[model samples]
Target: MDLTTRCLFLLSCLCMLLAIDLDAVEPSYYVDTSSTSDVIDYKDPCKAAAFLGDIALDEEDLRMFKVDRIVNVARQTVQTVNRTDPVTGSSTNEAGQSSVVPNRRGLRRWKRAATSRPERVWPEGVIPYVISGNFSGSQRAIFRQAMRHWEKHTCVTFIERTQEESYIVFTYRPCGCCSYVGRRGGGPQAISIGKNCDKFGIVVHELGHVIGFWHEHTRPDRDDHVSIIRDNIQQGQEYNFLKMEPGEVDSMGEVYDFDSIMHYARNTFSRGIFLDTILPRYDVNGVRPPIGQRTRLSKGDITQARKLYKCSRCGDSLQDSSGNFSSPGFPNGYSAYMHCIWRISVTPGEKIILNFTSMDLYRSHLCWYDHVEIRDGYWRKAPLKGRFCGDKVPEPIISTDSRLWIEFRSSSNWVGKGFSAVYEAICGGEVKRDNGQIQSPNYPDDYRPNKVCVWKITVAQGFHVGLTFQSFEIERHDSCAYDYLEVRDGNTENSPLLGRFCGYDKPDDIKTSSNQLWMKFVSDGSVNKAGFAANFFKEMDECSKPDNGRCEQRCVNTLGSYKCACDPGYELASDKRSCEAACGGFITKLNGSITSPGWPREYPPNKNCIWQLVAPTQYPHHPAVRRFRDRGQRCVQV
Candidate 1:
């Protein structure tokens, strides 16, 4: 039991303590570079080594050797035992960690388990995050702003803390390398130039990935809806990892959303072989359902997360009867009704004014109704009341309940074409309709009239009626046919009728008459030519009134008198005698004044000036006054 026994017992106890120490320490995470027993081509060793170098160790001191005189000397022997690459005889050193080499097959198998597991969501506590690269205060401000926006919308809370209890941690390191974003075991981390990090939206985007969202462009079924050019995708590269394992399913049964905020900005192929690209394709144009830097968690993302981590108190139990999450309805709630007749109620004796802008005459229609009765037929014309061709038109006024119906029709060929209509109500008494030849004082000579008829009429109080108009047919020709009728009680001035009609026609005839109006007839001393044919009535051919042959020669009809013109040489005297000549040709002296040689100068003596004949050669040559002068001239004969 002396020296031999004591030494053996001490050795056993030391061996036990060493085994216990190894068991207590957590295994350091490492990437496996292994070769298979059966020969198979693999990633290049150098490339693998470079990728390994990219792996950043959180605890760098753990790999650094302590510089001490005694320990340094003792470590020299063990340090000389070089770990060489299996394929190359190169000694492995700290830099060799960046070298790519196949790992033993057994080691690769052990890593497979850890890599296959999906990342766990951060517990209900603060998450620790790290920021790589130097960041200025402004850059951090931007990052905080984005984080705040995310926090407000989502359940996650990001706290910047330096301790392990802190959910998120940030570290700044200046590396010429472009900023890269990724999630460590705890929270999201980013690397970039300080100023650039502040300016770029990459922080929010990377945080999205940290929260388990995928890239929008990498949606598995996205190709079905969007055509992605093969050249845009990286060859032999996986841009995103599936949230669930290859065949696993979440509670919602939804696959990962490529458009998820967590996805990489560029496609797998876009980064090139080195998993790096000088410039990312920021053109979101062709990307359907456009994805952008500020893009937040989509509905699918929220729904999945919510299902997985539901609120215990106010979870799915709350019934959303208001349809808060329902998709929006058609045409929006503001102007959904297109052609339905609307019953508008107004104060008694109130006048309604309907106005439209830039009337699309071809595709617009208007109709009026009162007390559920369809008053005026649907009218297809430019807006009557509003500015047209830079001219103002009188707005129609509705005074009675009978005039309640108003219709608007729009026929723009564009699928989503629409125009604005404004209505104003004027409250007074009944409206007045003047009968003294309703005319437009401001009518322009070159105005082309619209086909629709707009009338200004008065109505008594208690007037109510239905108003409606049909929608214009959609066709290649732009259709903008809509009608809005408003009735108001005010004395608005008459608007100009922009077109001309040659034949003697009355305004009432155009509005109430069932007769069809034809274009003006032109005569060149021969047969007359008819104007354009326009339908005036349901069953009428022409609108012109008929007269006998003698009436055509010049027959006048007065309320109390009638007359007919005689032959060219005949004339009528003051005594009402119809004869060949009223006075003889000889001259006569009257009251000391010389009379004309051809006729009798009758009546007051002062009324007749001394007359004489003047030759046509003495006519005034002044163009200005001559233009107004009569054909013949007489000289005074005193």
Candidate 2:
């Protein structure tokens, strides 16, 4: 097979043996770390396996197990020795001998510790805690299975217990362990479980120690700690209690038992240094049955736990209180101490004014955050600032639906020191309601009305008129209810009044008399007055009559007026106001006839004659008329 194929085969085999699905591997697995020769020839599968195994193993077991387990076992048996204080380089064995020799490789495996400090003090009561972690579903299931085992064996409850006595909080940091602490004032004890621990049984085990249960593996009478076989064991890597430092040892000072739930699982052939002969088991009959894939807690575990720590009677409690308050006058019949955050909603291109009022002694400041949603599943934040004073504030005009949230924070150090003080928030706009509905005021209270009311009336020359009344409502009134209406002609201000009508009483009704000359009305005490439509037509009739010699024809009087006419020799024009002559030329058709004594026998025909200009002596100058037969030329006249 090609080298790559062989390597793939070997990796696939290893994965199957470990019960891991290769498809589930992360990208980090594909990294090439070996030299070119190693990659080409598959020179060292053990080294490749070691690297792959380290990645595959749980973080807790990475440093504890050898990668090439088979190869390491086949080598000439090397006696296992326990290393205590890997940092200080100390070692101990079953013989109780100790030596200091540096384990150079062991130092590389230590992890960094957490350094962040808690900012706020934990409330002095039962605080609820939750778990955060990196365990897969299967891994969590396995952990739970282990937990059941511990619970069955130990009386301690891992999930729920009295709050004052204990609370379990879990987290996911790798290579972590659980611990419990009693508070300084004996308020409560807390149990913290690490997320990295693979075996849930470890939780019950560690909690057991916190409550004072001694490890069964460390039972002094059993002396199983030194009696167990340790052959072909990988030193400083796995399954050796002798490797524990002084701190890892229990405070109770008991001997160790290999079968203890606390004991590490190790290879059967492992034997310890300084043992003259490898002991198969500490006690032949003392061997507990091997825990099945589904190991559970035993009755002995619970009995032993209850003997150490007793349950407490207290329950859980916590405290949270913050901020300030105020009581202020509210507009619109509302009043209360409101600890409020302002929210603004407006349409595009709309401007709104916000007003606030408060009577609190402290200076107040307003701060707000603008929350805008740009698109699906996205958001952005903007800051909003507003004016503020001890009693009032107004927000600047805004033009978007971009919602605003406002908070009023007080600056007086004295306020909200021990307990929060109440404050009221009031918001008002130019908008208002009348009755139950929104409306604009008919007349703005701020407006001033003009004093004079003028009316222009037009009437034909002849017609009787009655009462004229104006229609309007009074929105607001002064103490005296009086106003005047004036009437005027179409001409300039100097024009004469055709007639005048006046009365002290406010008329209920005003009408003209039958003669059409005067106005009349009933008088009541009230001044529900209206202006004149009185005998105005009568005045126009008298003014329109022909005056003096202006009319040369007959005078015909019409209702409220009159017209003029002329005689037969004078014809009246269409205007009926002027006269004109009807005769064309002078009197040329005169025959031997004389009508008036002023008639001429042969008149100058073209001469225009005036009515009073004709003379009696003009025609008879020769006494022809008196003496013999028209002595003037042809004495004919028509």
TM-score of 1: 0.27
Expressed as tens digits, the lDDT of each residue in 57-113 for candidate 2 is: 112222333222211212321343454433333356556433222234433211011
Error of 1 at 168 (Å): 4.0
Error of 2 at 146 (Å): 5.3
Candidate 2: stretches off by over 4 Å: 1-129, 136-155, 159-168, 176-215, 221-231, 237-240, 243-259, 266-294, 311-638
What lDDT is reached at residue 313 by model 2?
A: 16
List residue ranges in candidate 1 displaced over 4 A.
1-119, 129-133, 165-167, 171-195, 214-228, 233-245, 248-251, 255-259, 263-288, 292-295, 305-638
Candidate 2 local Cα displacement, residue 396, angstroms: 63
How well does model 1 score by local distance difference test? 0.28
CA error at residue 400 for candidate 2, angstroms: 49
TM-score for each of the candidates: 0.27, 0.23
- How many residue pairs clash in all the candidates, one count each? 85, 30
